[model samples]
Target: DQQVKQNSPSLSVQEGRISILNCDYTNSMFDYFLWYKKYPAEGPTFLISISSIKDKNEDGRFTVFLNKSAKHLSLHIVPSQPGDSAVYFCAASDSSGNTGKLIFGQGTTLQVKP
Candidate 1:
Protein backbone atom coordinates (compact mmCIF):
# COMPACT_ATOMS: atom_id res chain seq x y z
CA ASP A 1 0.00 0.00 0.00
CA GLN A 2 1.69 3.17 -1.15
CA GLN A 3 0.94 5.84 1.37
CA VAL A 4 1.65 8.71 -0.96
CA LYS A 5 0.62 8.99 -4.59
CA GLN A 6 0.86 11.49 -7.42
CA ASN A 7 -1.77 10.31 -9.86
CA SER A 8 -0.52 12.50 -12.68
CA PRO A 9 2.78 11.39 -14.09
CA SER A 10 3.41 14.68 -15.84
CA LEU A 11 2.19 18.22 -16.28
CA SER A 12 2.87 20.87 -18.90
CA VAL A 13 2.58 24.60 -18.60
CA GLN A 14 3.61 27.68 -20.48
CA GLU A 15 6.11 30.15 -19.19
CA GLY A 16 4.65 32.80 -16.94
CA ARG A 17 1.64 30.56 -16.38
CA ILE A 18 0.56 28.86 -13.21
CA SER A 19 1.45 25.25 -12.50
CA ILE A 20 -0.33 23.11 -10.00
CA LEU A 21 0.79 19.74 -8.68
CA ASN A 22 -1.40 17.45 -6.64
CA CYS A 23 -0.70 14.69 -4.15
CA ASP A 24 -2.75 12.36 -2.00
CA TYR A 25 -1.90 10.19 0.97
CA THR A 26 -3.63 7.14 2.38
CA ASN A 27 -2.03 7.31 5.81
CA SER A 28 -3.61 9.69 8.24
CA MET A 29 -0.49 9.58 10.37
CA PHE A 30 1.28 11.96 7.99
CA ASP A 31 1.48 15.31 9.66
CA TYR A 32 4.05 17.12 7.55
CA PHE A 33 4.09 17.82 3.85
CA LEU A 34 7.04 18.82 1.67
CA TRP A 35 7.62 19.55 -2.00
CA TYR A 36 10.88 18.87 -3.77
CA LYS A 37 12.17 19.83 -7.21
CA LYS A 38 14.65 17.68 -9.04
CA TYR A 39 16.73 17.90 -12.18
CA PRO A 40 18.02 14.86 -13.95
CA ALA A 41 21.09 13.37 -12.21
CA GLU A 42 20.83 15.78 -9.30
CA GLY A 43 19.49 15.40 -5.80
CA PRO A 44 16.03 16.73 -5.13
CA THR A 45 15.96 20.28 -3.81
CA PHE A 46 13.54 21.31 -1.09
CA LEU A 47 11.01 23.84 -2.36
CA ILE A 48 8.39 24.49 0.28
CA SER A 49 6.79 22.68 3.20
CA ILE A 50 3.59 22.88 5.22
CA SER A 51 2.40 21.34 8.44
CA SER A 52 -0.92 19.56 8.62
CA ILE A 53 -2.00 22.13 11.15
CA LYS A 54 -2.09 24.81 8.49
CA ASP A 55 -4.27 24.71 5.41
CA LYS A 56 -1.97 26.86 3.30
CA ASN A 57 1.58 28.15 3.21
CA GLU A 58 3.24 30.41 0.66
CA ASP A 59 6.77 31.48 -0.06
CA GLY A 60 7.67 33.69 -2.97
CA ARG A 61 5.89 32.35 -6.04
CA PHE A 62 5.30 28.95 -4.53
CA THR A 63 2.34 27.98 -2.42
CA VAL A 64 1.35 24.74 -0.72
CA PHE A 65 -2.08 23.79 0.46
CA LEU A 66 -3.03 20.89 2.68
CA ASN A 67 -6.51 19.57 3.39
CA LYS A 68 -6.06 17.31 6.37
CA SER A 69 -9.57 15.93 6.25
CA ALA A 70 -9.11 14.81 2.67
CA LYS A 71 -5.52 13.66 3.10
CA HIS A 72 -4.68 15.74 0.07
CA LEU A 73 -2.16 18.45 -0.77
CA SER A 74 -1.16 20.61 -3.70
CA LEU A 75 1.73 22.81 -4.77
CA HIS A 76 1.13 25.91 -6.83
CA ILE A 77 3.74 27.78 -8.80
CA VAL A 78 2.74 31.05 -10.34
CA PRO A 79 4.41 32.68 -13.33
CA SER A 80 6.34 29.49 -13.89
CA GLN A 81 9.55 29.94 -15.80
CA PRO A 82 11.52 27.70 -18.07
CA GLY A 83 13.99 27.15 -15.29
CA ASP A 84 11.19 25.77 -13.17
CA SER A 85 10.74 22.80 -15.48
CA ALA A 86 11.68 19.76 -13.48
CA VAL A 87 10.38 16.71 -11.72
CA TYR A 88 8.44 17.55 -8.59
CA PHE A 89 7.92 15.15 -5.73
CA CYS A 90 5.57 15.33 -2.78
CA ALA A 91 6.68 13.78 0.48
CA ALA A 92 5.04 13.21 3.81
CA SER A 93 6.29 12.39 7.26
CA ASP A 94 4.68 11.19 10.46
CA SER A 95 6.22 13.41 13.06
CA SER A 96 4.83 11.28 15.83
CA GLY A 97 7.30 8.55 14.99
CA ASN A 98 10.29 10.91 15.30
CA THR A 99 12.26 8.54 13.12
CA GLY A 100 12.90 11.16 10.41
CA LYS A 101 11.57 8.85 7.75
CA LEU A 102 9.72 10.36 4.78
CA ILE A 103 7.32 8.67 2.39
CA PHE A 104 7.67 10.02 -1.16
CA GLY A 105 5.19 9.96 -3.99
CA GLN A 106 6.03 9.11 -7.55
CA GLY A 107 7.29 12.36 -9.00
CA THR A 108 5.30 14.46 -11.45
CA THR A 109 7.39 15.83 -14.28
CA LEU A 110 6.64 19.45 -14.97
CA GLN A 111 7.46 21.01 -18.32
CA VAL A 112 7.41 24.76 -18.46
CA LYS A 113 7.50 25.62 -22.09
CA PRO A 114 9.00 28.89 -23.05
Candidate 2:
Protein backbone atom coordinates (compact mmCIF):
# COMPACT_ATOMS: atom_id res chain seq x y z
CA ASP A 1 0.00 0.00 0.00
CA GLN A 2 1.23 3.46 -0.83
CA GLN A 3 1.36 5.50 2.30
CA VAL A 4 2.01 8.72 0.42
CA LYS A 5 0.46 9.65 -2.91
CA GLN A 6 0.54 12.54 -5.36
CA ASN A 7 -2.64 12.38 -7.37
CA SER A 8 -1.50 14.79 -10.03
CA PRO A 9 1.32 13.69 -12.28
CA SER A 10 2.19 17.11 -13.67
CA LEU A 11 1.38 20.81 -13.43
CA SER A 12 1.97 23.73 -15.77
CA VAL A 13 2.05 27.36 -14.74
CA GLN A 14 2.88 30.60 -16.42
CA GLU A 15 5.70 32.68 -15.14
CA GLY A 16 4.66 35.03 -12.37
CA ARG A 17 1.61 32.91 -11.73
CA ILE A 18 0.97 30.53 -8.89
CA SER A 19 1.73 26.80 -8.80
CA ILE A 20 -0.01 24.37 -6.54
CA LEU A 21 0.84 20.72 -5.80
CA ASN A 22 -1.20 18.28 -3.79
CA CYS A 23 -0.30 15.22 -1.74
CA ASP A 24 -2.12 12.74 0.48
CA TYR A 25 -1.09 10.23 3.07
CA THR A 26 -2.77 7.31 4.75
CA ASN A 27 -0.28 6.68 7.54
CA SER A 28 -1.08 8.29 10.86
CA MET A 29 2.43 7.65 12.13
CA PHE A 30 3.82 10.29 9.84
CA ASP A 31 4.67 13.17 12.09
CA TYR A 32 6.86 15.11 9.70
CA PHE A 33 6.18 16.03 6.07
CA LEU A 34 8.60 17.49 3.55
CA TRP A 35 8.62 18.73 -0.04
CA TYR A 36 11.62 18.28 -2.28
CA LYS A 37 12.51 19.74 -5.67
CA LYS A 38 14.68 17.76 -8.06
CA TYR A 39 16.49 18.55 -11.26
CA PRO A 40 17.49 16.14 -14.01
CA ALA A 41 19.90 13.46 -12.79
CA GLU A 42 20.32 15.21 -9.45
CA GLY A 43 19.15 14.33 -5.98
CA PRO A 44 16.09 15.94 -4.58
CA THR A 45 16.71 19.09 -2.55
CA PHE A 46 14.55 19.98 0.41
CA LEU A 47 12.14 22.79 -0.22
CA ILE A 48 9.87 23.13 2.78
CA SER A 49 8.51 21.04 5.62
CA ILE A 50 5.90 21.12 8.34
CA SER A 51 5.67 19.24 11.57
CA SER A 52 2.38 17.68 12.63
CA ILE A 53 2.23 20.32 15.36
CA LYS A 54 2.12 23.14 12.80
CA ASP A 55 -0.54 23.52 10.14
CA LYS A 56 1.55 25.71 7.93
CA ASN A 57 5.13 26.61 7.12
CA GLU A 58 6.57 29.04 4.61
CA ASP A 59 9.97 29.71 3.12
CA GLY A 60 10.44 32.59 0.75
CA ARG A 61 8.12 32.03 -2.23
CA PHE A 62 7.30 28.47 -1.21
CA THR A 63 4.76 27.44 1.37
CA VAL A 64 3.61 24.08 2.78
CA PHE A 65 0.26 23.49 4.36
CA LEU A 66 -0.79 20.43 6.29
CA ASN A 67 -4.19 19.21 7.37
CA LYS A 68 -3.67 16.57 10.00
CA SER A 69 -7.35 15.80 10.23
CA ALA A 70 -7.58 15.05 6.52
CA LYS A 71 -4.21 13.33 6.27
CA HIS A 72 -3.36 15.70 3.43
CA LEU A 73 -0.86 18.39 2.55
CA SER A 74 -0.04 20.77 -0.26
CA LEU A 75 2.71 23.00 -1.55
CA HIS A 76 2.17 26.43 -3.05
CA ILE A 77 4.60 28.53 -5.00
CA VAL A 78 3.85 32.15 -5.71
CA PRO A 79 5.16 34.09 -8.69
CA SER A 80 6.43 30.92 -10.28
CA GLN A 81 9.66 31.34 -12.14
CA PRO A 82 11.28 29.37 -14.96
CA GLY A 83 13.89 28.02 -12.62
CA ASP A 84 11.15 26.51 -10.51
CA SER A 85 10.44 23.89 -13.14
CA ALA A 86 11.33 20.56 -11.63
CA VAL A 87 9.98 17.34 -10.20
CA TYR A 88 8.56 17.74 -6.73
CA PHE A 89 8.26 14.83 -4.35
CA CYS A 90 6.27 14.73 -1.17
CA ALA A 91 7.99 12.80 1.62
CA ALA A 92 7.03 11.73 5.10
CA SER A 93 8.99 10.47 8.07
CA ASP A 94 8.33 9.43 11.62
CA SER A 95 10.65 10.26 14.52
CA SER A 96 8.91 8.00 16.99
CA GLY A 97 11.98 5.93 17.98
CA ASN A 98 12.68 3.79 14.90
CA THR A 99 14.84 4.71 11.91
CA GLY A 100 13.95 7.95 10.17
CA LYS A 101 13.44 6.57 6.70
CA LEU A 102 11.72 8.89 4.26
CA ILE A 103 8.85 7.58 2.19
CA PHE A 104 8.51 9.59 -1.02
CA GLY A 105 5.75 9.84 -3.56
CA GLN A 106 6.23 9.21 -7.28
CA GLY A 107 6.65 12.94 -7.93
CA THR A 108 4.83 15.79 -9.64
CA THR A 109 6.55 17.53 -12.48
CA LEU A 110 6.01 21.30 -12.42
CA GLN A 111 6.64 23.33 -15.53
CA VAL A 112 6.92 27.09 -15.21
CA LYS A 113 6.56 28.59 -18.63
CA PRO A 114 8.06 31.97 -19.37
The TM-scores of all predictions, comma-separated, are: 0.98, 0.97
For candidate 1, give the lDDT of residue 9: 99
Distance from true location, Cα of 12 in model 2, Å: 0.4
Cα lDDT of candidate 2 equals 0.96
User: lDDT at 76 for candidate 2?
Assistant: 97
Scored by CA lDDT, what does every candidate get? 0.97, 0.96
State the lDDT of candidate 2 residue by residue for 16-43, as single tens digits.
9999999999999999999999999999
- Stretch of 10 with least lDDT, candidate 1: 67-76
Pairs clashing within candidate 2: none
Sliding window of 10 residues with minimal summed lDDT for model 2: 93-102
What is the model-wide C-alpha lDDT for candidate 1? 0.97
**Residue 22, candidate 1: how far off, in angstroms?**
0.3
> By TM-score, who's the top model here?
1
